[model samples]
Target: MAFPLKFTLVTALLLLAACRSDPIQFHTLTPAQVGDHSRTTVGVIQIESISVPPQVDRAQIVIRQGNSGLAILETEWWGATLVDELNSALADQLSNYPAQSGYSVRVDVQRFDSVPGQYALMDVKWRLRSAGESEPARVICRSTLQTPSGPSIDELVLAQQNNIKRLAALISQAAARKQAGCLMPVN
Candidate 1:
């Protein structure tokens, strides 16, 4: 009986320690707001590469009537916290372009149906990966620059800003491609 009890207690302690370990999470880079040729320009669209979750394990203990004890039980979890963090960072960075660039470039946060006369909802897909051996991560990011046939000047400005942001990020990634180590944009 004593042996079994001790085994259970030890198992519980180990499990607790594992649970208390700090969780790993990724961080995002700041967006660059600058002016260029009278048009608002984004110096860089810095995005971190998506990260994988750490492994987790749980321990369990079992006791036998014969006064023997056994500890056996481990589990793992696949969390998407990293993904959520990236998504939030991207959305936040994209949404702030208009104000940061003096509204010279527009940053639209609304959704609608069609493009121009046939207005439709816009779809966005963003992907990021390491470029060979570069210092910056390369990203394949896209967004539908949509508006009514005659979008207001503000709307058009926002669209251009959005495109510029995407372009800056992509160009940075491309230049950074061919090396691995650096994961964020420089300058």
Candidate 2:
């Protein structure tokens, strides 16, 4: 009877251990803390739309392997939808620019991928239109931002955030040029 009880207890413990899983972590692309606080405020900018690739539209972090494969990290997740996070970050980055009227920005992300120990890349086509404008100015931006990473996902996220910030800066510059009547034709 004693032996049977001990065996049952051991089996229960093993089962419990096998069923346990590591807690999942959620992350977001937030704006960088460092900024020019003294910069003048820009008029409100609305993110009209943000579209991402279907492969990366899910909550999990998708990683591009080589030419032919991808990996979705099951334990890692975005704090919100990827589009929402990118839009929020872009808005935050552009808040400092001064503008008299609201502007609308649209972003279509073609590629967003992170490779561990390598780089994070974002290829995007974006449009900016001032209030009541008949046409929007468009540009395609490609960023390959690099960062050092160990076996952790945090570094990859940081790199991606940086790339988004860079894109926002480009948009802000383009908006300023447009306001100054020096807008360039999209290529």
Best model per TM-score: 2
- Cα-based RMSD of candidate 2: 4.1
TM-score of candidate 1 relative to the true fold: 0.22
Model 2: pairs clashing at backbone N, Cα or C within 3 Å: 42-97
lDDT of each: 0.34, 0.74
Candidate 2 lDDT by residue in tens digits, 1-187: 9999999999999999999998889989985567556655558566788999999998889998888799998899999889888888877777755555666787888888788878777877776777556755544344333444444688889888777767766677766663333232221
**Candidate 2: where is the Cα deviation over 4 Å?**
32-42, 133-151, 178-187
TM-score to true structure, per model: 0.22, 0.82
Task: Report the C-alpha displacement of residue 141, candidate 1, in angstroms.
Answer: 15
Give the deviation of candidate 1 from the true structure as CA RMSD. 21.4
Task: Report the C-alpha lDDT of model 1 over 1-187, residue by residue, as the tens digit.
Answer: 9999999999999999888854432222223456442433353233443332221111111111122432221221112342443344444454444221111111222221212222222334444443224433234444443333333323322333343345344334443455422233222
User: Which 10-residue window in model 2 sums to the lowest lDDT?
Assistant: 178-187
